[model samples]
Target: MAKRARPGMRRKAIVLRDIDPPGTLATNLFRAVYNPVVQAWASGAERIIAAYAATVSEMTTDAPADVRAEIDGAAEQINRLVLLLTPDLRRWALSVEGYVRGRWRGAVLSATGVDLQTVIGPEDARQTLANYVEWNANLVADVSAQAKQRIGNAVFSGLSQRKPAREVAKDIREAVSMSRARSVRIASHQLSSLSGELARERRREAGLEVFAWHHSRKAHPRQDHVVRDGKLYTENPALVGKKVDGIEVRAAPPADDRAGVKPFCGCRERAVMVFEFDD
Candidate 1:
């Protein structure tokens, strides 16, 4: 933590090369969001299976009509499942966005020894946060769409194959699990991306044009991102190869050009404010 600053005075910047991400918070949010959704999905899967089994005793081998109608209804259950969970997602999005913003502010304060709230007023903060609203919406939409598609595919493919009720139920269970895992990944990635964006905007406003690159150091990190660790970057990357303080942009450029960083990249821009002349 940075020391308390007196009114009308600024504290010296901390010599920190790596200001870590809000990993704990991110993980907690993932569980908070994933667990309930998975449970609900599990229940929905059960309902789907139940639909197919309602007339199980009447079913005979190659009863194609029963499989088609019953399993189609099963697919519809997934649609309802998405609708059932969407309201909760809206609430989750709002809360997670606020939490990520708070974490980003804390990271800035710790790295630069400046109070972000003091520098970034309430209106500016709200406006900056508001600009990223679409990201949250994307979370909701993508989850819903993917869930429906994956489960629908499982149901339809099983129907086409004329698989037994038990086998179809198995397929649905696997699909629900797959959907949950994919949703978790999307949630975690978006949080990382959002925090990275917040860091860039807030740091630049605080006269922090240069930043120390922080590699997440997670398992199986990208080769390029690993090489970027502990280096410095400017907003302008037109000169990627130019060395400043021995920064060599030999690593491959990010695939996404929108933010000068790629989604799920896990790297962060820690504000590096130079406070005094070198001896």
Candidate 2:
């Protein structure tokens, strides 16, 4: 006779659809909070880039020291811009926290019929906010670093190739322009990821039994996520904590090492409700 399946060993698949479908809640919330901050950052980044471009445009000779000094000076300006935007970034973070908290509470209630506030308590909310603050700080730091690297590369490459000042200026302009676009995309993606993570946490805390990875058809489907899409995993301590494709689905911060939730990734998580047991 075939061996019997262990208790909770065979997961019954459950499809947890996105609470806020793409371009609906995710896009709207992200734009509402992120647009103003990103616009400010873009404005500051452009000014810095323009200054660097002007310096390069005026360069009569490709002196490495002079080029390096100009690049360093530009990096300082970018750092200052990041500092100037800290208040706005903090506001954006708070907005995200509020949005995620509400969505998570609603999703848990809808899936399990349990009020998340009653089960998870205020401590969980505080922890969630703490995580958001850390995540936001890291994001701002990354933007600063990217700006420096991008500007530095433009200056170094143009000078190395001895490109004409006007051409170098053009390249810098293009780089800065691209950065603005990328910033918006990144902000949107991170908002989606944050929501997925918080919702999963709330569901787990509310004693849900299963969880599913919701793949984005709009995203370039990765084999890892594609294979796992819509499939369910038990929320038992052993299984939920187990790594699949280098991602612990129930991880507090949501695993970032994978393509689905990595920077600019648009994947979401769906909390699966199994009625076999009652909480």
Candidate 3:
């Protein structure tokens, strides 16, 4: 007689199998930013692979064959990405490291007007970068764990054959949907964190204002622009054109092409300029 495994147990096993790849999964575990590129670069490839596998597994649970095929494809993609990155990042890291030592170090110091002796020092910078890489690696691992848990829960939930089969499909779909949305949000937050650090470093080296342009062209009667203290304010035309003190207002080409400056919007119309006094 063939031994029978409970649906829940079988589903759980399948989920685990899909999540856990065979062999050493820690091939590219280092951070590319700090490590000698080749030594510490993860290429974000592992996360990508895991995400794809989770997605396909959730969608194809009803068809065991499809799930298995998807897993194979995901594995291949992961391997290919890692293979391509191994040599590329290694060479890049060496080149970048050499550049930093030969020219970038002096240029960065000179441009930022930061005294190497007064601040944390070059040795400290390297240490800080290393710490950052390790922190991110830990974060990735935690996220991966949570993702696997979600997949397991979904698979087990669907294993209840007592429920309508469509219900199971719906459960799988919802689980995959939530997983993808959450993953995107988490990745976005991480990227934002990194961007913030880079921005701070740039600001510390050279004090400057960073402004992003937002587009607003609904072309409604209620829409109007107003001038405030050296800036533009908007609400409705009825509230616009109010006189203000110590400010100059004029219009110029909307698309600014000054060296080092780029226009934020594609609108070819003229943009109002507002200048204000310190007082």
Candidate 4:
């Protein structure tokens, strides 16, 4: 029997990458500073005010010079970085948290004996995967856009003498396209890691068989393409390329007790049945 992932223990491998980038200092520092404050606030907003006051008092003028300097340096770095990337970081972080706690962990638990809906919420498992894939695609778009903007700004910032407007525009455009392309590639790599983490979670779920399933964005499954053998292959054409043994891929209702999934799940429209390998 495969060992199950511990409850409340997040997937370690991909979570690090999904974290928001720091403006300065170590990235984890932000989480360190923010998590406690947030936890305090969540527990009791009134008491959190007193806790906040205590935290403020902890930073006294009599503190050692070395300690003060270290704190100042870290603060400055974070401030600078936040100014530069706050908008993007904020947007991405919201999505990342949902993917980890709700999407990723939820699925892992549902696959095992735990009822995710009862433990967390009904939407936890499916929402986790859905938001992960959706936000990942959005991250690609945002990165591409930011890369283009960066390249354009970089080119204009340069002191170029006697450069024609049209020529400069064309050059900047090409550079931006290349930059966005690179960003897409990098984001794709990150998403690939996320995919692997999801797969790992699926493997760790107990008494359930999980299969990777993709369906067409449109109503017609016939129109979709899948990556196989380092090439794009259509469903019809690839059916002849390889034979899957005793693996019947089809769409069907989940077992009645499956994490208490409702009959008319909103995700059902996009769902494809994946084989669960369970004892």
- Point to the candidate with the largest lDDT: 1
What is the Cα-based TM-score of model 3?
0.32
Every model's TM-score: 0.69, 0.66, 0.32, 0.30
- lDDT of predicted model 4: 0.34
Clash counts for the predictions, in order = 0, 0, 2, 6
| Tens digit per residue, CA lDDT, model 4, 188-257 | 3343333333333433332223222332233332221221111211123223232123333333233431
Better TM-score candidate (2, 4): 2
Identify the superior model by TM-score, candidate 1 or candidate 4.
1
Find the 10 residues in a row with the least total lDDT in model 4.
Answer: 264-273
Candidate 3 collision pairs: 30-40, 31-40
lDDT of all predictions: 0.57, 0.56, 0.32, 0.34
Query: Candidate 3, which segments miss by more than 4 Å at Cα?
Result: 1-125, 202-279
Q: Between candidates 1 and 2, which one is better according to lDDT?
A: 1
Query: How much is 143 displaced in model 4, in angstroms?
Result: 8.3
After superposition, candidate 2 runs with Cα above 4 Å error: 1-17, 21-70, 108-123, 235-260, 277-279
Q: Candidate 3 vs. truth: CA RMSD?
A: 22.8
